[model samples]
Target chain A: MSSGKIVELRQVLAERFPREIPPPASLLTTGIECLDRSLEGGMRRGTITQLVAPYPSCGSASLLHDLIDSMHTSASQFVALIDGKNSFEPLGNTDLLLWIRCENANQAVRATDLIIRDGNIILSILDLKQNEVQELRKVPLTAWYRLQRVAADSGTTLLLITSHYISGSCFAAVQINNPLRINDLAELSYTVSQTRLLDFIYRKNYAELGYAQA
Target chain B: MPKPSLFAVIYTPYYRLQCAQQKRLRTESNQQADLPFADRQTELSDQYSQSYSSNSNSITHQTIPPVTVYIREDIASALLEDSQIIEINPTAEAAGVKIGITPSLAVARAPELQLYAPEVELERQQQQALLQLCYRYSPFIESTGPGVCTLDLRGRRNKNQEIWARDLLSRWRSLGFAANVGIGPNAELAAQAAKFANPYLEVVENSQLLRSLPLESLQPSAYLLEILHNWGIRTLGALIQLPREDIGQRLGLEGLSLWDRAAGRSAKVLHHLQPPEIFKETIDLEQRLETLEPLLFILRRSLEHLVLRVESVYRLVAEIKLQLHLDSGDKLERSLPIPAPTQDITILFRVLSQYLETVQTAAPVVGFTLEVFASDPAKHQFDLFYSRLKDPNRFFQTLARLAALVGNNRAGIPERLASYKPDNIRLRLPAFDWKSNSSISAESDQPRIGPALRRYRPPIPATVELADGKPICIHSNLIKGHIDKQRGPWRTSGNWWDPDGWEIQEWDIQVTDRGIYRLTFSAGNWAISGVYD
Candidate 1:
């Protein structure tokens, strides 16, 4: 048969005898409605989910602290946060949180690689949002792809936080654009966390996102 | 019905000499791995054949004079003036080198004689290895001597004793020791059989082999043996032929014991020994090591052997202690604790290698000793709602790597200090023991206060345009914007009585279209402290 006809015949056979699909992996919830809803309930295991904060006072740090608090209190799981610019402030109960305060983007990426590959942590947050864009640009694209492969192999949830879209290796991306005002300082953190809105920006497979396996 | 107790004795003749040879052979084998394939096989074949023949009792004819070798305690070389030979290889025996003969006489008799000194540490290590291997056969084992041990086979019911005996022999041989195993009704007979066995032997009650054995096999004192020689008692059968009461009356208590041992009727009281849980390996480098690769290579090999030993004892390595002896008469020691006890070599090696990477040696290392503390594997029951670390050892190793990448005090479980100083936080290593006591409260009654602040490490310097004691516009390299609204000058200070005293006037302000930033005025200088996100 011709190649086109052979493809048609295989499609017909596939429709008649469909392959069994495995169940999707369990999701790790951050307990934030807006972010979780943007992630379709929560971040899926063995995938990279990027959170982009385009401007200062965009509530990325607030979101990160809320996520860490939610992991510690609600799920009782360990979270490793690789702080990109060493900018994270202490807040809430951090008994189950492993915070690695790195000086630059390179150190943060390396720390992220080490934590993700350890396979002991359930969720790893790479917070590079506060880093200078010039330094963040120096982080090779291959590092993200390598991290994606490691996360996939280790069956971990890797949340990459950045100032803008930097790599196509992530499985999904969401933009946190809530601008904070001086008045918001008087409000409760949980209320602010609940009021935050996330815009779902990107979702695709590794190959579709230009991360081809070698 | 209670079965008769059978004793098995494992003995190695010239144990100190053999330990030295084994150490040499091991060093040679390690060097051989780098040799060409053709040269490696030929060298190994020649050396191993010589080693096997030296341990063998069978004699072979030689047309030419063989290389005769002997062991002495104080010899620096074969030409040492007055050192006496304590142990001699079979070839040395054929060449007329007698025990207790001086090295000068030994060389005079055998022109190509070689002398070696005993390695006390290596001998001790091999003896411990032998005991550890024997413990696998029976829990009730005794350390009879430096190179001998006896296992009590009371409850074991395998009729085919040769299988396990051969198995034990092969296992001992794998560690470079040539050993013999003998099983008998009593410990005395078993020890006698072990000295005579080609590789293995078994003797029963009143067995002809036991009767024909010479009196020297009983290890009587020289004085007693001389008396027995005068009496013309040449063999155990002859000694046992005399009436026991008559010998006891004539020769006293020592005579009675000797006769009992001869007749295969000695007491079987074994001082049972519980093998020590010491897992250590040390190596003295042939040349001083000045680089990390070779040191790491040795460490990796040592860790493998230690892991094997720990696994054999049904335990895990809880901690590793490394001591590096330097050429400058100094020792650098480090102890790395395995958060979760494990038999995994990779994790253990990582712990060691990571430590070595940061070690700053003052001199080239001459040797290193690695010792592991063994522990029972930890067991824990996690709560249904709680998730525990999947691999604690690997996670700790990763934590170490993260610490290397970041600062040491910058990575771990973060806890806020009790003091009111802003950003007063410290990182502590996570607890290794995973006891699920519900120490962490699952739910908290405290409310989340507000959005978290991202603090600038050093507080970015800024020029503030102040009007009426309130900051208006902020002009910094990072952020330059006019202030639309301002909060207050919150004054906070502490530690005024000490050298590290601090005071600050902090204000929260909103710069138009830029962000909400915190400004601190301290010591007549204004800075952007952090951003409230």
Candidate 2:
């Protein structure tokens, strides 16, 4: 069949059976008030969500640790962290976190792909925040799309933590605009607790966009 | 009378020869697998070069025909000595080699004939495989002979007898043994039917089918056979025409039994025995396995067969035991326990492969045996609040692959070691059952301490200038900047009595505008320890 005919047939079917269309998927709430509120209840499942940390001392790493901690304590779900730079420090309880420490951006991305495809982990965080920008730039865009498709198929939540926005197929992107200060070191937990995350871009009809690209 | 007890016999023709050929094929495949990629490539290239060079000399390709082979009855004798050939393959028969012929005469008939001694161990293993497959059909089974198994289908529903028999025969074929099934009213009749069966046969009317047979079919005594021959009685129908009481009184008990057998009336009871539950397969390699590829290939094949056996018995493998015979006369034995009792091949392979990846043997392996312990499936009830792994086997397999990609110590659940030393942490293997936890409540609820430090492994050495016991300038591979703010000179020490004692002073400083970093002075050297993130 030609592409035009297929599209027409799909349109006719959709119009004929409007009520049969599925409702939007429920979000996966991490139980973090700030994050859940910013993401409008929680992160979307089966899609990539980019969390950009533009500055070095931003609370992205802290947020990751707390996010994992909260997920474990509240929901009792497992979280997988693909550490790009092998820099995460285990200060708190990490009984539910499966940390795969990699040396570079390429290794981290591959690890993320494996974890997502396994489907055992509900939320997978690919932390490329500390990796070199040049190395992150070398990651092909097609790799991101492949990851998105796998996540969609597996019904997994893939959160990409980066210094700059790299995934064009992400369902949404959130930025941590606040940078840590020396005084904030006195009460680090309090500072992280006060973390303010801003939503930058959210594709409400992300599935249509993904289909278009595909 | 109730229906006569049906009997099914699974027969493998030329069983010893089949076992030898199967083993030879396996060994050849293992040798191919053992060859490294470069060596295999070189071999291929050599073959190609030889073929290309030979093409110019001949318009037609010349090939060496395979030599006809037969198994000798008395394997203890030397090949040159005169020996009787017991089992002959089709190739040998096609070349005019006949059974019961002397080796010398057979060689003269088929000059390319190759005689092989029987392998008792290989035949035993093949027989066990046949019995294991037969056990799937009926419980009252007998090890009737070398290549035959008789199953008593007394209470079994005979509606789908042909279907299950075909399935059983196919399973036997998968183990590299071509077999046939015959169902009859008696064991002897079943065995006879199996020999002539086209893969499967069933005796419907025993008297009608048995009457046409010659007296030799019952293997009567030579004296009795000669008398019957003189009496002009060649077939069972003719012999049974005589009165049974008169024949018994005249010919004796042996004659009476022979007449009964010829009439398809078998009074012999079956000596039933349980099929051995032990699941193990061993191979003696022709070449010592110095690399892992061939060993893994052998193991994967063996494990697959063992799993099939376990499945046939309606059980799960609880543990896998691997024993390797090394050239140095030492055996390496290891048992790997499965987290979940499962028959998944991928998961079991991962468990074995992971162990092999880390093992360092003192000598090349000459042979190996793989065994699996079977168990009933486990039952577990989980808490309502927590979620468990959807597929534990697949999850563990993925974990093994991840461990291969990353270092073993790098991928797992991170546990903080109990010590004052900084960055003291170890990875714990993840559990199959995951529980929802709130163990972090104490730490999370505790007054906020500070941001988590992203520590650099093997803290980078740095050149520092200090004034008034405070760091003023810092230069390292990570950061080179003037200290905009400095906070700590916290002193700590541990293990003072031991030679591995250490003392350190740490300072949390802001690198001008770069970031807040942790600087440490230990053993009279300044280093950038970590960055606060």
Candidate 3:
């Protein structure tokens, strides 16, 4: 209907075409290969995972750094890092650090106090190494429940990177350990060799396997 | 021993050119304007073999010419709702078309340049705001123009400035802007370097690339630029090979700047946003009510908002414009002087209301707009002295109410001749003169005003029916009589020509029991001035 220009345009277009598919989207990869495999294609935006780091320098900061670098829009973002010991250093760029706030520290309250706070995403890192976490006999059970509700209500992923603690009040206690296996090899030398084991497990799910670590 | 050469410490300031100035720059002609250039060069050559200075042997000049984003008319629709695209079309030439043409062509086709002009300005503003974030990285960032900004990622920034630059590019892109940054020894190169869609980073060390770039990238006007392109002399290298004389013969004076630009040199520097001379916002209400409550309330909120906005930028208010629009659509703009910024809403409220009352409210007020102009060069230092009585904000609130009742004009400081000689030179007027730069110098360092001086307006003749010098009044105006033990003709005179410029010098006369009394002679009449310690 649009005339000869259409016919000329059609004749001009009967050639090659660029691919319609877009370049592959880049995802922030967790260096732990086994964990990455469990995550399928790695942590997508909606996926939430618990970060239970038992020690410092155990790649907790490394993971966050990679995530922030990959996202690259944290400057305008509202990031909440509840550093119990005030150790969550927002690295990368000073320009990026301008928008993050570290609240819920040196507090005067129950965990319920933190539950009411506002933020786009909340990262509450409790220092299991601190005396406060170790001696929490006075903390009310309601406080712990409120903390969980805070993360759930806000839809914020709460990464609890902490040291290992021996809590006596155990009800079917279970531990998920890093896959590294350290075995005694005195015959060889003082230096030891180990294989890193990476897998997920739930004792309750494995009734037959019982308490075997995956 | 050989002396080592030190890199030049360049200090460039961005001068905020007024809108009129920018317009003037756009219209300035180049070829005809080159008469001065030819004459200057001729004179220089006569004095010294000009080639010595003109030698292009070592091209030290860097071009950081600013690139304003230009969207072709067709590209407009594509960017209409895109916030990432800062719309700054100065000319609506391409009002019909909407998006997708090359960046260079978008610039070429734009006639009115509304899209490019305004976009660049807006981009510059956003960039400056970005600079607020960038300030954490380095204070060396200088704004050359809208979108045409320069930063000296010098010192420690040398290590991460590239990464920072890359990150910034991504940030801008995410924000929906096609931002390109070029960094060189100066701003000119950085700007020209920003034209590419990809990360365009250039250093003076990368000067070799400048030669290969087109003369269109230099300072050529769009028309002449198109001609050069059609001629196939696309690159700077192609243009430079032409005898310098021929290029000059054709392009004229712009040829000189072009030569400098081609050498990657920019004479244009960053322009700083000096605190605005006047920042104002006026609101027109739906209807007019005579009561001072709402007017005062509005004034309070507006003052708070203005203070908050300017405080982050600069401090103090030099002048205030209170424009009241009557229901009949008549606007009365009352400009007033503010000695300094008064955070106290009450003070402003009172002042504005009083000014409002001065308005013969022939019709109900439909709306009012308040604008404050301020500039504090940091010269006026304050000395430790007596504190101001009412908080500025509180004072405004009070004044706002008074203005609403009496009129804003009447609510201001009444003229009292403080000087013995009331000449234009020595007339002691209100600290805040509505027509002057009322900002106080150096915050404060003055002998405190006496308690008597707190509230003093000149005088009305009082009948001295000599009693114990206490006080007395008859109602025509407040009248008080006291024994005149100390006497002196405190003569105040001003305005040799104008009838309004009168100087009434007052004497601090003390009676044996009345303590200190202020007596002034105005219109050849003596009135009780004020009390003093």
Best lDDT among the predictions, by candidate number: 1
Better of 2 and 3 by TM-score: 2
Looking at model 2, residue B336 earns an lDDT score of 86
RMSD of each: 8.6, 11.3, 31.4
TM-score for each predicted model, relative to the true structure: 0.83, 0.75, 0.29
Q: Candidate 2 chain B — worst ten consecutive residues by lDDT sum? A: B62-71
Candidate 1 colliding pairs:
A189-B449, A189-B450
lDDT of 2 by residue, B379-420 (tens): 778779787888887787788788888867878988777678
- Model 1 spans with C-alpha error above 4 angstroms: A1-23, A205-214, B1-5, B28-82, B89-98, B101-115, B129-141, B152-175, B221-233, B245-254, B268-276, B281-286, B293-305, B433-444
Measured on C-alpha atoms, candidate 1 has an lDDT of 0.79
Count of steric clashes across candidates, in order = 2, 2, 101
B1-533 in candidate 3: lDDT tens per residue? 63321111111111121121222222232224334345433443343233224435232122111112111222222122232322333232244333444444444555433322222342333344344433434555555544444555546424434655654543333222345666565566666566532455655633667777867666579877886777787887676666777777887877756766776555555544332233455554544656666666656545644543333243455567888777787887878765545333344445566665556667777666777765562243332432222223333443344334333343232232444342111112223211212222221123122221211233445654323433232221443334434445456566658766676756554443324455665665557554331
Q: What are the chain A TM-scores for all the models, listed individually? A: 0.85, 0.84, 0.45
CAPRI quality of model 2? acceptable
Which digits, one per residue and each the tens of the lDDT, describe model 2 over residues A50-162? 88888878778788877887888788888999999888987566778888989999888888899999998899999998898899889998899999999988989988999
- Tell me each candidate's i-RMS in Å: 2.4, 1.9, 32.7
Error (Å) of candidate 3 at residue B270 is: 10
